[model samples]
Each structure stands twice: as structure tokens, then as C-alpha cells.
Target: MSKKGFAGFDPEGLERAAEAVRELSQSPHAQSVIQLQIRQQEAKSEEAKALQKERELKKITHDHEERRKTLQKNLEINKETADYNDKLERKRHTDKLKLQDEFQEQQRKKQEESIKREEKLKRETMEHQLKIEEKRLLIKGKVDAEMYRKNHDLHKQELLMREAERRETYKQIFQLNFNQLSLGFEYLMNNPSFMYKFFLYTASITTAFYFSRHSIQLGKNILFLRIETNLQKKLYIFLGSRYLESVIGKPSLIRETSKLSYKQFYKFPLKFYKQVTQNEQILKKNIFQNIILAPELKDNLQIISHALINKKKHQAPLRNLLFYGPPGTGKTLFAQQLAHSSGLDFAIMTGSDIAPLGSQGVHELNKVFDWANKSSNGILLFIDEADAFFRKRENWNSIEKSYGRSRYKLT
Candidate 1:
């Protein structure tokens, strides 16, 4: 009761405050404030969403830039690597070219050196051969000179001996004549009748001398003719003249006998005719069997005969024989008989005949061998007086002192 009386204090203030809260809750201005607050909260949420979207876009751009930088770095590294590889390839190519050039140069130098060495060796060999040839020529010249000198001396000696023989013959003839004249004078003095007898004797002697000389000459001529006839017949048989005539329809020119005498055919020595005639006579007589020989000589002959007969079958070697003995040992006879019995052609030549020919002697000797080879039958060459020509070369005197003399003699 007193609440209204105290300075207007209301005893229902708590209830009135509650009633005011209920009225404010129903007011339009309060509802408007609540809606504005809700709108502000939605705006804040949208702004946060936009900021998140912006951060995502920025992260994408940053990632793209980093990827681009990495790509550019890779491109630079690849280009640098390519450049290094190209340089390396070029260096290798240049080194190969250099090596190839060096190898080729070395080969070329080796070939040139080899050629030079070969040339040098060839030159040395040729020079050595030339020197040997020169020495041989010098030796040959010396030998020729010595031979010429020896031959000249032999010829000179022969000439001197011949002159001496002629002189001796003339002396003997004159001495005989003088002695006969002296005896005639002595006989005339002893007896006057002896003068007439002496005249008759002289006439008889002169007549006898003339007839004897004529008879001897005639006999020689007859013997020579006989030998010539026999030689012609032998040549006709040996040369097969009948066969040759049949083929040629005429006589062979070689078969025609020469009418020339010894004097006309002076080139052939008289000994050549004598040897030919002697050989013919020995063959005709068949004297080999009649003649006696030493046991060794007979055995040698038998051996030679057997060898000759079996030569073609056995291929036996033929050796040269040397017969040295005193004169008249029947060496020539045996050789001729051997040739005849063996069916071999024989050529006889004397060393004296060869000496006169000088250098032509060698040529004639060669011709003899060549002709012998051409014969269908084998040939036996008999060189008489071989010792006169085939003396030891060591025994020959030097040619220096006798050069001019030898030259004159040769000419």
C-alpha cells in the first residue's frame, strides 16, 4: 500500500520489463535488423569463396611458369650436347684424314728407297761384270800375241832349215862333179888311149843319166796316174755318184775329176797326195792283219773296236788318244786301218801345213770339224806331226821383243 506513495516507485517493475521484452519481439524494426545481419554473414561467406578461387588460379600460373622454365633448360642442354657431339665428330674425321695421309706418305717413301737400293745394286753388278769382261779380253789379247810370236819363230826356223838343206844338196852335187872331172884328167894323163875311152865313157854316162832320169820320171808319172785313178773310183763309190746322177739327171759336179797337176793345185801340199795314195794302197792290201803289233796295242785296238760297235747302245764316251813314239812306229798306219775297219771317213792333215795358214788355220780347223759332223759316218781326223804345232804354250817366248818381226812374218 505504500508503493505508490514513495516517489512514484512501482511495485510491478519486473513484470513490466518482461512485458516490454515481449512487445519488442513483435516490433517490425527488430525483424529488419535480424534480416540485415543474416545478409552480411552470406556476403562474408561469398568473399571467402572468391579469395579461395583466386589462390587456386595463382598456384596454377606459378606451376605453368616453372614447367616452361624446366622445358627451356632441357632445350638448352640438348642444343649444347648436340654441338659438342658435332665438334667431336669433326675432330675424329680430321684425325682419320691425317692418319691416312701419313700412312700413304710412309708407303711412298719406302717404295722410293727400295727403288734406289735396287738401282744401286744393279749398277754395282753391271760394273763388276764389265771389269771381269775387260780382264778376260786382256788375257785373250796376251794369249793371241804369244801365239802369233811362237808361230812366226817356227816358220822362220823351218825356212832356215829348208835353205840349209838346199845348200847341202847343191854342195854334194858340185863336189861329185868336181871329183869326176879330176879322175878323168888323171886317167888321160896316165894313158892317151884313155882319152878316147874317156870320151866314150862320158857319152855313155850322159846317155845313161838321161835315160835313167827319164825312166824314173815316167815311172813316177805312171804311179801317180794309177793312184789318181784309184782315188777317182773310191770317190765315185763313197759319194754315191750313181744315185746322185739319177736324182739330178746328170753327173754331179763334185764327182767330176780335176785334171790339175800338183803344181797347179799348189795350195795342197805334196804330202797330202802321198798320204792319200799310201792310205789307198794300205786299204787295198789289207795290211793291218799282216802287220804285228804289241800285245797292249792290240788289246787297245780291240777295246776301241768294241766301244765303237756298242757306242749307240751303251752311250759310251769317246776319249781323245795321243800316240807319241819314234818315227815309223806305224801310228798313221794304225789310225788309217782303224778308220777303214770302223767304216769311218778319214781326214789327214799335217801340223806343218797348218803352221803356214796362221789365223786361217783356226778357221780351216773349224771347217774340218763341221764337215766331219755332216758326214753320215763318223770321221777320224789324223793330224800327223802334231808335236810340231801343239807344243806347250808355257814354253813360248814373250811376244814383246819380237812384235815387229812377228808382224812382218805374218804379213
Candidate 2:
């Protein structure tokens, strides 16, 4: 190598480097070192690339975890909202069912009340119709009775006219015969024997008439002539007290004795007559419907009613019932109902009247019992204030004295 100074390079160093490169290039160790260095660089580059790839993978994993947590939270919130809405819907449905049940209950109650009112109205209407029918029947009966009386009177007048005509014809014939026999009658009157015979015949005829009249009077008093007498008129005439006569439902066949105070005699008879003549079912319905009593009492009364009806049907003797109670306790009403139920004729009498009667009390009581005995269907004698009449025998004398004192005072 030549030594050169100024060539814009280090001449000495370049000449030494060129000589070293020529020597190294000719050595195999130099080629091995270069190959090793190149391999090391390539390995470091590969390591750096691998580290970058690992960091990118870690970041991707973290992002994925965060996204999963957010999705879970949103899902949880949506589920809670859905659960709350479902609970609210269930509560609303329950409330709707409750309201519906209440409405149905109210409607049912209204319908029941309406039904009860309708039944009450229908019952009242039936009762009204029954009353109207009863009144109409009563009027019709009165009209029929009046018509019968008028027809009977007209027939009696016609019979009297015919009898008068027959009598006139007989009288005219007798007069003609008397004219023809006038001379003979005068001659017979002059004869003593003929006069005696005529007087005897007259006496006999008069005696027979007197006896017949007395017999008839006795027969009437004993009620043996089957004559329809005006007992009410006779009683009124004798007693001199006002005797009221009110025509009840139907005309009675048998004449009844006069009642003292309340004339429930006619009223009860009318009811009994209706029971016999009208529909029995309707009559019983009317009676029981009008009566209000305890369940047990009503049941017992029904039993008695059935038994009494049975006895009446069999024509058996009926039992007497004594009702003891305070005033206005429905005793009289119950007795009337029982009589009507049993289809028996009832007569009401007051014991106060018996006390006033004095000596005639026993006779009147006997008369009542006798009358009851004669009844075909049986009679229920309802005596009000029975304590007044029923007393010890010793008390009767005092009652009689009191009655006498009253009579004296009245006189």
C-alpha cells in the first residue's frame, strides 16, 4: 500500500482496512461470525413481533370481558322490570275478580228482595179478592132470601084468595039451604027434646074446641108442633130490652137463642156454615192465614184441629177445652178459630149475664147445653169470663142476694 496524505480520507487507515478485509475474506472463521450475527438479528426481530401479538391478544380479552359484564347487567335489569310488570298485572286481575264478585252479590240480593215484595203483594191481592168474593156471595144470598120470601108471600096470597072463594060458595049454598029449612028450624026450636039435643051438641063442640086450644098451646110451649116461632120477638117483648138482629152470611135453618152482650153467635154460625158450604181448603187457608202464633203453639193447634175434624167426621163425642188466660190474650179468638176449624157450630155467652140472671141461670145453662146436644154437627159453647159464673155453692147464695138487690134497685 502507498502512503498518501490528502484524499479527503484517512489514507493510512484505509490502506490498513483494505489489507485486513483481504485477509479476513480469505478466512472461513470470518464467514461463520457473519452468519451467526445475521441469525441473532432475525431471532430478535421474531421475538419482538411475538411480544406485540401477545399484548394485542390480552387487550382483546379484557374488552370481551367488559362487554360480557355490561350484557349481563342489562339482562338483569330487563328481567326485574318484566317481573314488576307481571306482579302489577296479577294484582289488577285479582282486583277485577273481586269487583265482579261484589257486583254479582249485590244483584243477587236485589233479586231476592224483589221476589219477597212480589210475594207479599200477591198475598195481599189474594186476600182482597177473597174478601170481595165473600161480600158478593153475602149480597147474593140476601137477594135470594128476599126473592124467596116475596114468592112465598105471593103464593100465600093466592091460596088465601082461593080459600075465600071456596068459603063464599059454601056460604051461598048454606044460605039457600037455611032459607028452605027456616020453617022446620022454628018448629024444632019449639020442641023441647030437639032443643035439648041441639044444646048438647053445641056444648060438646065447645068443650072439644077448648081442649084442642089448650093442647095446641101446650104443644107450642114444649116445641112439639115443629112450628117456626118468632123467639126473638117474643124475647124482646118479654124482656123489654133492645134485641138487635143482624143477618149474617147465610140463613140458619134452626132458630138459635138470643145472645146477651156480643152476638158472636150469628158470626160463628156464619163461619161454620161457610165451612160446610164453601170449599173446605179455602176456608181453612183463610182461617190459618189470619192467625199468627208461635211455631210450637201453631203445631199443637193444628194437631187439635185435625183431631177435632176427625171426631166430627166420625160423629164421635168431642172433648171440651178450657182456655185460661188474661184478658185480650186471644182466648176468644182461638176458640172461634178452633170451632171453625173443627166445623162445629159455636155459641158465645157471657158469665156476667148469668150472675144477673140469679134463679134463671141454671135454667139458661141447661137450655144452652140442651141446644148444643140437639146440634147435628156439635156445638162449641164459648163462655167468656167463666170465673164469674163458676164458684163454690156457698158463693151462689151471695150472688143471688146481689142479683136480688140489683133487681130491687132497678125496679
Q: Say which candidate scores most in TM-score.
A: 2
Computed on alpha carbons, the lDDT of every model, listed in order, comes to 0.64, 0.68
Error of 2 at 170 (Å): 63
Give per-model TM-scores. 0.29, 0.33
Give the Å shift of residue 294 in candidate 2: 3.4
Tens-digit per-residue lDDT, 90-172, candidate 1: 99999999999999999999999999999999999999999999999999999999898879988899999988986776687
What lDDT would candidate 1 get against the real structure? 0.64
Show the lowest summed lDDT stretch of 10 residues, model 1. 250-259
